[model samples]
Target: MENYHLTHEDGKYKLTKENGERASKVFESNKDEAIKSSKDFIQNQGGGSLKIHKNDGGFQEERTYPRANDPKKSKG
Candidate 1:
């Protein structure tokens, strides 16, 4: 599974793959758009994790695609 990251830089939001490799496009100033784009890319790749980061470089949240890969089981 690949890992995608959502981070803010230079007054804009960026979506990048592992090791800081640039993603397809740049999000000028919208974190929402960046998150959506990251999810779509992960879905297209079959499955992966989207890690959203705060402006301070701390992890905000992690969303897994396909659901099965999630480490914490959801109680029904």
Candidate 2:
């Protein structure tokens, strides 16, 4: 599991994974549909999640996962 942040921009959304990996995708014309699709994509990328925080000039938010519990965390 990992934490990923999704930011909305230009009628699309950008995703950043826990390891700093990033990707972007276009969503449906409907705002709600776009948000749902973004969330689903994040969830499918393992035990991660997404959340909306602010609707500034662009949609901004932070996604967090338990450091000790996330499966993606490095074991040392």
Best by TM-score: 1
Clash totals, every prediction: 0, 0
lDDT of 2 at 5: 58
Let me know the TM-score candidate 1 reaches against the reference structure.
0.75
Give the Å error, residue 21, model 1.
3.4
Q: Tens digit of lDDT per residue, candidate 1, span 41-71?
A: 7888888988899988899988888678776
Tell me each candidate's RMSD, in Å, in order. 2.9, 6.5
* Model 2, span 19-73: residue lDDT tens: 5745545553555675667667765555465545343544355343332344455
* TM-score of candidate 2 versus the correct structure, residues matched by position: 0.48
lDDT of 1 at 20: 71
Q: What root-mean-square deviation over C-alphas does model 2 reach?
A: 6.5
Question: Where does candidate 2 stray beyond 4 Å?
Answer: 18-21, 57-76
